[model samples]
Target: MYWHIEDSRYRIANPIQYLISKLGLSMDSLSQFVLGAAVSTAFLGRKIGPRKAALVGGVLGTLPDLDVLIPFADPIDSFVYHRGWTHSVFVHALAAPILGEGLVRLFRGLRDHRWLTWMTVFLCLSTHAVIDAMTIYGTRIFWPFYPDPVGAGSVFIIDPLYTLPLLGVVIWALFRRNWTSRLQTSVVAVLLGSSAYLGASLAVQRHVEQMALEIFSDNGGKPERVLAIAAPFNILVWKVIGLDRDSYRNLYLSLAGGNEPLEVYTHPRNPELIACLEDTPAYQKLDWFSRGFNRAELVDGRVVVSDLRMGLTPGYAFRFVVAEADGQDIRSVTPKRDLSLRRADAEDFAWLGDRLLGIPAARAAEAGFQSTTRDRAAFDCSTD
Candidate 1:
């Protein structure tokens, strides 16, 4: 079963779930805002003294991330609530004046400098949500009034291509005098370059989606819609999934191999298994959150629901035993997060690296005949 392109809203979730899972380090939303604040402070921090810029930038920048301490059941709960209301425009605006005024009052020297301090704090804090919206990692920029988190699906959470330029400029600014013309030029250039990079990434996504549409239709798979998300660390390659009701087709498409034929892998959704679970709030939320880009499979006759947006099939980031089927009814239904699955291994990383470097994996998605027998390009897995 596949979803139609017109009917589906292709969202870009955190696509590198497996890579992070294997690496054993996850940078949450707090760190993200802090990084953003550092850059913003580079420009706005001039309002305050140069020496205090880091403190102002770091403290105000990451203040929104304090939501992490709100406490939740597990990583899943943390993910849902971390960037919700806390990252909203209302919170940012409301928190800025209280925080800025409070900081000013506490610092005797800054008691007289409320305007500049408030502006600095506002920019540092407000920009947090704006930057996060660019990453496909859900950010509720509009919170309470509109709870749906907005995602541009433009850039990854942490891409070197985007961060390196900004980091370099920020470092150089910290060393140089505050708001020098040279530093200003450098910051402007970096911002423009990063914006252009995100624009280019979106363009590439469109190209990949178009190619996926054509490829699927040509292969007699009339997909209703498709989502195109880049691989981790880079946007040179992408994981394209064609969605339908009964089953979904997924495959790798490299920007390097533009317009080249790709092999599509099909997996059944087993919607009956998903629908049979009563009192399954999580399953429904997950289904809606994933935008139906999920697969419900039967393992030994037990329903295993996985969020296909994060990792590859059979090993997605979030999977749970939602139900058990007995003829016409589901019983013993229990939604439990299964983190034991090996979503990313040495082989998977190696395979992904090869594909990222224009070396397509030998196994074709649909018919094994096309890309089969191709040389398996060896990738360095020693560090992994």
Candidate 2:
């Protein structure tokens, strides 16, 4: 998965609960994953000399994310930038031999053992690519070498279970210099075990969804679509989102501990808000890019377009949010969320649809403050 470094730095000095509630994972995981890969290189490549080891480590640490700069080349290729060329095993294979040969000449001292250096470089780069392939986000590993994205679809982007064990092994290895004995075995064990655990988690989540379907069916409503997400690691809190037959009958089930299947909290879907987009060309273009994960809602007169494929929440999470199709001075949208409303709150439009059944809000809690805050008047489109 592509961890935008800019996004990680923005959430520093927060509690784990705050991180989980807002950003969905601890910020420290980002540091550990990158640093651990570098440390792993240092552990394996010391005989090749420390400078070469550090070079291999640094290159391996950064090679997977080289695709982030792809946007600078062309604006139309933003999404294509992430999980792109660098993530491919074919690119790693081609780049590693070239990098290893370059390092041998540049370092001078490692000229005699050039093959070992090349092997170390190839292994380090290849491992980074393989680690990324374990996540749900697809990576075109083989590229022109294969053209198919190798996706495990097991772990989420911010999985502590996968990160922490590997981190723990790296930390242990950092303290103990010997790489061939205990540390190597421990690192391999943790890495492979984490992958197995995530696979099991995916299987368990699928079974839980089947159980949820039966419960929803028994409760006198059939869900047209369901999205089940295991909150954090242990499947303690599973968030269940369902779109009923009418589409407006949206339901949210926060089932804790996984065993007991809850019916659902009374929530309504507002897919009709997407209908309001029929008048806008920009929205139509965005919809094409979003690939059915797009959701549009009228908030404070201007429409709020959310690409659900990104973040489930706002604030600390990163998403591609844009203003409505109204031609006005609405400026730009950023990685930060508009805290005034949420995906759940936007579902209220369905209630607004039912004039007979409606209710409603305070700015204090909404604005991340204890007291009411003034709503900054954004571009108003109704009068326009």
Candidate 3:
């Protein structure tokens, strides 16, 4: 549900294309050359000179995101984990002095360019913060001093419309090194243009929020907080969470298609039959992987529990995998009737704490329910 929307500003995917479209290196290897050119440009007029400057720029530019490779991390978990600390101001402050000192020692003979080495580290690290601030995933630029996230709310996570031109210019600049000034100027201009576009997109998202609210109001409903998610590229899908004053209906709305009128769908959010999966051994075991998605409830003659987060798009019908009590241990039971049955209260669903974790059903492997042992035994004795 989270997008690192701000990482794109400083980290151009195709810098060569950016150079060429605006300046002149229109070749197949434009991407690599433009990246080299950007580094060299940053490190120019220093101890490292053009070649080393390019090397420093290229390395530091990509170094900000290296902490993403944490050990024992799951594939999806990596996306949720914050790649913030290493990319924050704290890391830059600590890293710069260490890097600068090391570089000075390595290139000690060039004492005249010592300041350039320090400047290279500072600028390279600073770029990470600057670019991160331009996206939706806010950066903690003033870390240690301030922990608040600074989100510019500019730029979608994946927008080819804004990138292609910037990349083209970078590629052109690499081919025609003489036009560095023009190419650099164009790069700044493109950055500014993209910022403006992102601001406009935020404005568009706000208008969408307002329209969604109005739709709810027109239908005689008032929403509390509305979250607008941009689908595909420009389409807005709004989920409105609200409690009706009289009937206390929980309503959710969607404006997915276009600007005509939002399609409305109402669900009981704070339903009277609220389910709570209490503290239990199995539930505790699944807790690490569940991530606040598990809920247990009793409906009809059985106990039904579900993982709300797993089957989000399919609706509640797909959310809960039903189970019932066989005896002392709750066992897996197919939902025999309609799925829409509601519990009278939160406590009505409280007794299903054990069943939600599937421990009872797992224990039922020896009982009348389906078991691997039964299948195995039948196969051994059968001649036919």
Candidate 4:
């Protein structure tokens, strides 16, 4: 199950593998569940009992992510549409009162507290979208009105520091078999702590962005755009990407490593390859989805584009083969997931640990930084 879930290139062999894959992809949902259950238990638990309120909250938390089950035409559609209509703030606002009224009708205990119930339902639904936008992955909160997805990139999608405290409090409240003032206080405290963690992540991101700008400017390179994202499970170390005209720079900065000269790696953007497929739907979708932080390259006669924000250098999480090259002519193909690139290994995590502590290590080359210009010489577009 671990093997299959770790790699998208492998198909699930059995029901267990399929289930594990679903569970693995649902980390964000689990965090949302924790958020919803904790908040609901804090507010409505005294009225409806802790367990029942938690159950309702857990359900509401995962409701937004049900958009995953919506079938799309291809992987690209699934990629861009996963958090579309269902995660919209407008949809949640419209549905909250209806869902709240149903809850009030179902449970006679919530009859007098109609407004409170509606507010809880709305918070459970809307907080999920708000936290999702904090991550690097995009979310469309204002659906019909706003076309572009919002990704603050302040925090990683899964952070133990943010989720664990609230989860622990919720679990304790559930086992109490009775709602008490102590449980309410604890739940509210943890929720506030989690919110503070989120606020700290945004503040740290701004600091990293400022540092990245100073570094780039000192080198006499003005990046068109700069993005700072938290590393895998912690915000102590940030992965910063600077997008330039023909190249993008990748750097890792640790809060502990202050005023140190960091090594920055530069990679080709290969815009000429992307230009060949400008009219293709796949290319356009990825371009808009990644907000221009994408890189294109020709690999083995295939034109591949990658979203640079998600994964390490040379091995991005989202890479698709959008076009095939026959001699000098580029032919658009049905964009297929490119899974030939290597995945992160133990060595990467070891490097992460050292880097997080502000200890200098050998460089990212051992991790995932590899030369991507190998196939560039094969297809010269200077004349084209």
Please name the candidate that would achieve the greatest TM-score relative to the true structure: 4
How would the candidate models be sorted by TM-score, starting from the highest? 4, 1, 2, 3
CA shift of 256, model 4, Å: 2.2
The total of clashing pairs for model 4 equals: 0
Residue 12 alpha-carbon offset, candidate 3, angstroms = 31
Give me the overall lDDT of model 4. Answer: 0.80
For model 1, residues 265-373, the per-residue Cα lDDT tens digits are 7767755555554236656666665666787666665667787766665566567665665654456444556554556666777766777777767432234422112
**C-alpha local distance difference test of each model:** 0.62, 0.48, 0.41, 0.80
**Backbone clash numbers for all candidates listed:** 15, 1, 25, 0
Q: How many steric clashes does model 3 contain?
A: 25
TM-score of each: 0.79, 0.62, 0.49, 0.90
**Candidate 2 ranges beyond 4 A from true positions:** 1-55, 70-81, 103-153, 219-224, 233-236, 243-269, 275-291, 309-384
| Cα lDDT, model 4, residue 4 | 13
Give me the displacement of residue 125 in model 3, in angstroms: 4.2
Alpha carbon lDDT at 250, candidate 1: 79
What lDDT tens digits, residue by residue, belong to model 4 across residues 22-47?
A: 66466656798989999889878988
TM-score of 2: 0.62
